[model samples]
Target: MSVSEQFVGGDGVISTPIATGVGTGEKAEVIGHRTADAKPSGEYASILADTPLQADEAGVASRGMYSPLTSLCNEPRFATMRRGHKVMVGQNGWLERPGSIAKKPEQPKKAGFFDSLKRIAKEVADATEMKSSRRVKGGERGRASSRVRISLDPREQSLLYCELEFLLTSALDCYINSQFNAGRLDADKYKKVVDAWHQKGRPKVVGFRYDLETQLDLVFLHMKDFRFYGDRASVPAAISGILEAMRVNARALRVRTFCQPDSVMAKQLLDSQSLLNLLGSAEQRQIQLAEVVQFFKIVLEREHKLQRTEEVRGLPQ
Candidate 1:
C-alpha cells in the first residue's frame, strides 16, 4: 500500500479532482460519511449560494442566527437616508427607507439628526464581546482563534459630533486650560482628554471604533479655527451659535482670529461702516460690538444659572 489513503466520493465511493498527494501522505479522506448516522439533515447546502448547511436541528437554528442576511437595521434613532439628505429619527424602527426623496435642505434638518445620533453613540458603550463563530471555532483554528471585525457607519460620526458638542459644553474649557493646550486646537487638548477618557470619563464598549475618535478630533479642530465668521455678517447667526458653545478656558489663551472691514460682500451688508453710509445709524462699531456683547451675556447668564443650581445642591440652606 501507499503511505496514506486518499479518496473523493460524490454520490458513490468514486473519484474527483483531489486525488492524492506525494510520498508523505499522513492523512486520509474517507469520501463517504463514515459516521454511524449517515442520514442528511433537512438543512440545504449549496456551494454557490448561502443555503443553510446543517447536520442537526441545533446547527440549523445557529445558521439562521449567524446568516449574513440577518438585519441589524431594526433600531430607532439611527441614521437613515430620507430625501437627498440623511434623516436621524425613525420611531422605534431604525430600518432605512432608501430612495425616499427630500423636499427640504439638510441644514434645516441637522438638529433632529444631531439628537438621534447622540443617543445611538451613547449606546455604543454597551456592546460586549461577540460569540465565537463556527468557521473559526470548529475547523483548524479552534475556539481560541480571535475574531477581528471593523465597521464604519455614518451614525457613529453623528453620535461622535454629539459627544464633541457635549464635551465642549461640559469639559473642554477646564480640561484644555489645565493641559496648557489652549491654542487653535492642538495635541495638548487631545492628550488631556484621552487621559481623562482612560481614567474615568470614557464609555465602556466592545471594540475600538477608530472613526469615532477621528471625527471628534476633526470637530474640535474646526471649532478652534473658527474666528468671528471671517467678518461675514450674513452668517452671523451661525458663528454666534458656535461661539456661544465655546467658552474661554485659559486666562492666557492666546489665539489669533481676525476679521477686517472689507472681507465679504455679504458681511459688508451687516457691518456698521456700511450702515453708516446707508442710514448713518450707530457708528464707531458700537452696533456690532454691542450685539456681540449681548450674545455673550446671554451665554454667560445661562452658564451662571447652571452654576447656581450646582451650588444650591451643595448648600445646607
Candidate 2:
C-alpha cells in the first residue's frame, strides 16, 4: 500500500501528494533524502526543488498560503491596521478601515453680477408685456368710437332730466347745510338719491353729474367759506360754479331734445336752455346775490311745476 499527503508550501504554493510503496515481503524504507541536483516538476516543483528561499524577512512574514480562509486580519491598502478594528472593502477594491478615507470638500457655485441683473431685467420685461396686453384689451373695449346712440321717449327723457336736477339740488342743499348750519345729511338717503340718478339712461348728463358731485365733495371738505369772504368772492365763485354746472346740464338736454324734434320735452328744454344761458351770461359779468336768488327761484318754480303735473297725472312723487 502507498500513503500520500498534500500540503501547501510556506511561499504560498500548493504541492502535490508524494507516494511511497513497500515491496512484497520487504520492510518499508524511509526516503527522506533526495539528490541535491534534482529539479521538481508539476505540483511538487516548489516543495521538492532544492532552490534557496529569498532572504527577505518582511516578504516571507507577510505572504500567506491560505490567506482568504486562515488569516484572521486583512492587510490594509492605504493605512496601518489595528487590532479589533473593523475592515471594509472600498469602492476601488481596496481594504478600508474607519476614518481612513477622506471625503471631498464641496464648493458653492457663485453667480456673476451681470447674470443677476439679466435675470431681474427678464422678469421686468415679462411683467411689462403682461400689463401692456391688459391695457390694449381695456382700450379696445372702452373706446369712445364704439359708443352707440341711446333713444328715449319724450316723457321718459323729461322724467330722467327732472330726476337728475332733483339729485343735484339735494346734493347742493346737503353741502350748504353741512358747511353753514353744521348739519349732517343722512348718508343713506344721499347715496340712494345719487344711485337713482345713475340708474337712469342719460349718457349726456354724466359729465354735469360728476361736476356737481365733485363740487359737493369739496364743500363737505370745507375747502372754502362761501357765506363771506374777500369782496364776497367765495359766494360769487360758488354761484358761478353752480351756474356753469347747470349750463352744461341744460346744453345736454337741448341736444337730446333736438335729436327728437317732435318730443313735447322740446318746449321745456328750450325754456331751461334760455334760463341757463341768462345765468351763464350773468356769471361771466360777475355774479350778484340778486341773480343767485333769481336762479334759485327759477329752479324752485320748475320743480313745483313738475310736482303739480305729476300730481295731476296721478304719478308717484
Give the best candidate by TM-score: 2
TM-score list, all predictions: 0.16, 0.19
lDDT of 2: 0.34
In angstroms, give how far residue 148 of model 2 lies from its true place.
Answer: 5.8
Collision pairs in model 1:
75-94, 83-101, 83-102, 233-267
Worst 10 residues of 1 by lDDT: 43-52
Tens digits of per-residue lDDT, candidate 1, 1-317, equal 11011123233222112213533323233432222323322211111111221222232234322211112222322223245554465533345456654465556544453244333322221221221121362355543433322121233323322332332222222222222211222333333444445577444221112123332343344443422212333465544443332322111112212221111211212222222221112222222223222222232234334445766797421
Q: How high is the lDDT of residue 185 in model 2?
A: 24
Instruction: Determine the backbone clash count of candidate 2.
Output: 0
Residues 42-133 of candidate 2 have per-residue lDDT tens digits of 21211212222221222224443221111211223212334764435865535755776778568768766434433433443343333223
lDDT (CA) per prediction:
0.28, 0.34
lDDT of 1: 0.28
Q: How many clashes show up per model? A: 4, 0
